[model samples]
Target: MKIDVHGHLSAPESLYAYKANLLAHRGAHGRGSAGVTDDTLRAALTEPNRTFGNQSHLRHLDEAGVDIQLISPRPYQMMHSEQAKLVEWFAEETNDAIARTCRIEPGRFRGIAGMPQSMETTPERWTKELRRCVTDLGFVGAMLNPDPYEGAAQPPALSDRFWYPVWEAVCELDVPVLIHSAGCRPPARESYSLHFIQEETLAVAAMLSSSVLDDFPTLKIIVSHGGGAIPYQRGRFQPGALRAGITFEERMRKLYYDTCLYTRDSIELLLRAVGTDRCLFGTEKPGTGSTRDPRTGRWVDDIHLLIEDIDWLDDGQRKQLFETNARELFRI
Candidate 1:
């Protein structure tokens, strides 16, 4: 029962419309185009659906030994820079596409909804859309952007009161939120992977340092990208937690991480620092950087083999990391 909890979906029509809107707006502002060129973006957006239900994705799953994938909209499709209304509409279209793909092979896929996290989006709207995704669309969870204020505007941090309403809704709904970053805005943080890592790590640190977990103890968050350097920098944060009279391990235990670190040593470090129970199997497959490993001749995104190669994990622990943890976290 292997499950990949971190996978992305790109609905071509929805994405193309969003890109068109962005380009038009940017041109008006004399900012030209934003992000990828038209041709590249369209190709990447359509590639996932080309073999969505035609056994191509299934064949990749079979070869990679993944039994199920919890598909969410591609990070870029969140469109946090757009107006809140457009963002919500884009989310609906993206989720509909995901539901359609899941219907093609019900047992092979589940859905994680995308949220309209633009600065103007209200908590009521967020809750309504979340309920729609869960009760109506049968989605298991959602992706949350810690900061959605694009460009020069800095939004309130996740620990501030601005996010309390969403936190309340999450606890009431009993669904986990995968903390994911979308689109880099800062000049120094232009690289996608680097910016994502920085944002996710800083968000987690801020959450830990503040009273967010204490305020909503039942809230579940899965920090993507192997907890984003948190495991490696435990020493830097431990002293602060100790001085603040908080249990560092207890706070960390409440959160979960996914296996997208892309290397054997990094995965081992995550397993050691975060433990097996808190780590969920995830692979952002069929996206960028999924090249064949020269040594193994397997796609680098095939992370199941990476876990299998770890010598210390017994069968029970491996089972927990590969399947049980995700099942419990996402309620799948």
Candidate 2:
């Protein structure tokens, strides 16, 4: 019953071709279909490639002892900074691809939709697609891009009223959201790797400092990459939180974190900071940390192995980390 919550789908090549055409035409061509077929999808997943992100991913999961993986669109390819129409269409295509993958193996996969978070659109507008993904496509949750403008333009912080519509909808739908960031467009800005951590860290800070959790106490947000440095640097904000008359650590406990941290020490620190109850097993297999570790002779993304080796985690805590917490969070 091991479940990994932070996996991304490798989209079919036809989807990318459609994207290239859409970008090339700049909306003059009007929106076209994502011509991905069953055969092309088979080719995409079954064939060998540089990363096993999608290529034979099921086998990789089996070898790593994962029973299920929640699949979402690759955050970097979400195209959130494009025009509203283009972003909407591409998001549909990307979500459809993820839906198809889950349909191919319902027992082994669940879907987290790619939202159309284009800059000009409000969070309310994104809920249309969010609802469609949940009710119509049978998705369990969605991946939210914190910076849809790709650092070109700063959007409203997650704590602002601008995001209330989406939070309201999330309460109505009962689906959790993953706080992930998309590509970096500015030449001088950090790469998506660094940008991911920066945005996630900011999201944690903003939400904890504000009354978002108090306003929407039922909202479930799982920040990726081990909650983006909060577990390590929480002391920096403790003084400010004390002045404000709230426990900073208590606010942090309200949010969830995924075990995508690569090293044993980092994961241990996350558990200590956020608690085992707040952590879910997640391996971004075939993504970052795919390379074999020079020290351990195992794929760095084999997080279950790392968890199994943690001597301090009691059996119940290990059970919670490897299986129980995800089932409870995803309601799967």
Candidate 3:
């Protein structure tokens, strides 16, 4: 039952241009070549040499020795369309695409639907999409970025009351909210390059400090990129919170984190901080060595090292980290 909980899928071929255009636009503005435009993604789509296009990503997962991979559209795309009229449609299409992939091999894959945060600006919109993602699409959960709005400089949407609507919905769905890193506001921007993990670190801090977890006691959250430095800085957050007359260590204890860092030391530190029960396996894939199977454009291989590296873990801890914990959190 070894499982890698964090995995990503490319935009279906029809959506490549939309992504490429975004990257080209950002590149023009000095955002760096990190952004890949639709053309580039499309070329990957059409390239005969490449295997991870759209259809065969799962085969790669098998090669990686992963028994299960939780798949989702890019987290950034959770906010793909800002226009109110397009939010529902965007959510529908995204979930539909995810559902299609999951159907290919029901037990081996699970989908995490992307819900637009902006649409959640209103309570009703949040309710609708959350229901669709959970009930209609059969997705296990939703993926959220650290920031509420894409390209904005602020903490997580958790600080805003508008997001409460979605928070409530998540609790009702009994699904884990997967929070990944994104951009940050000023002062924080400087760390973006040096500590690329900062965005998600700050977001987890905000969630613990804010009253979200307190408000929804049953809500579960999984942080990406090895909990983005939070486990390493757990003590730092509590002392500061106490000094400010706000203590949240107890609530912070409820959070679940992933092991996406590539090194053994990094994984050991997080395991020590959070303990094996609160940790899960993740590879960030594609960015690592996850390419696609030749015929199917889907992910062929995923974050497999997490399991191979488990000889250092206690037998019980290893089982919880790779399989049991994720099953309890995701109900898969």
Candidate 4:
């Protein structure tokens, strides 16, 4: 019954074609995996050199005891990188590749399609792509970063009327709109630092403050990174949101958050703040320093400790936190 709602894979079907693309863009974290071209990308899936390939990804899933993985692309694919037209093509290709992968395992793995956030594209084209992802490709929903880029440099907020058509399609499809935290230009903060957490927190806050959910009430939104500090800061920060003519509590109730905070204490606080039904399981698999402890000879299962420490939660609550909640949220 264990399911990991957060997992990542690159487009293996076209690795060779994008090798140069990958090389040009080193990971913000300093090291980079070998980039793949179109031809080799497909080949790389079966290869071990790339950790993001199918073989490596699936191996990690099995080792983690995850029965199901809801996979999405690494952020590059999600950002609609180069431009609108190319972004559209990339979205289609990535979704198609994931659909193909899910077919091999049936219920064991699922995918969320990438959405293009380009300002240059026609609204009709954006709507059409979203329809295709939901209806034709069989994806659960779409993945979106809070802001495609950061600060004054980033494009207009996702709540802008320009994106109304896209939101309309999402509402019509009745799938969750997963808001992830990344892709900010200049990053604006260190990884896992207070500023990093604050950046995501502010993004969600801005969304709520802008009344995105109120404008599109039917669209279910899932905030990643343990709801990005929203649960903790809601009471203290909500008044400003309210004063700015936004009231998201009702809409917020419909939103869900993933448990990617990586500690029992943080997860417990989130559960209390958002409730068990609103929390889903996530490892941020291969999270920073994801290696095992060499001296203790331990695999370092974080969730195991989370379950053990939260004794107040009944058996049913634990089961819900670990598995059932995610299945229902993703409609798996």
TM-score, one value per model: 0.86, 0.96, 0.75, 0.77
Candidate 4 residue lDDT tens string, 102-161: 666666677776666554665556667667877887888677654444332555565677
Best by TM-score: 2
Q: Any idea what lDDT model 2 has?
A: 0.87
What is the per-residue lDDT of model 2 for residues 50-146, given as tens digits with 9 covering 90 to 100? 6754336666688788888998988888789888999999999888888888877788889998889986788889999999999999999989888
Better of 1 and 2 by TM-score: 2
TM-score of 1: 0.86
lDDT of 3 by residue, 1-332 (tens): 77778886544555544445444454344322223344544443234334343333444555566788887766545443354434444455556656765665577668887665553355556567768768877889878755544445343355567567667888888888887743333434454323336667776777776777778888888888777777777776777768778554454557888888766677887877777888888875544445554564434333445445657777788889888999899988
Clashes of 4: 12
Q: Is candidate 3 or 4 superior in TM-score?
A: 4
User: Model 4, 173: alpha-carbon shift in Å?
Assistant: 1.0
Error of 4 at 327 (Å): 2.6
Local distance difference test values of all predictions, in order: 0.76, 0.87, 0.64, 0.62
Ranking by TM-score: 2, 1, 4, 3
Residue by residue across 1-332, what tens digits does model 1's lDDT show? 89999988744453566557754574344322223334443344344444343224445667788888988888855768676666676667677777766766688889888877767767667778888888898888888877676434677778888888888888888889898888765554466577678778877787876888999989998989888878888877787778888756656766899998788889999888878999999887655536677888877777888889999999999999889999888778
Total backbone collisions for each predicted model: 0, 0, 16, 12
Off by over 4 Å in 3: 18-56, 78-82, 86-88, 119-123, 153-160, 182-196, 241-251, 288-303
Prediction RMSDs, each to the true structure: 5.2, 1.6, 7.4, 5.7
Superior candidate under lDDT, 3 versus 4: 3
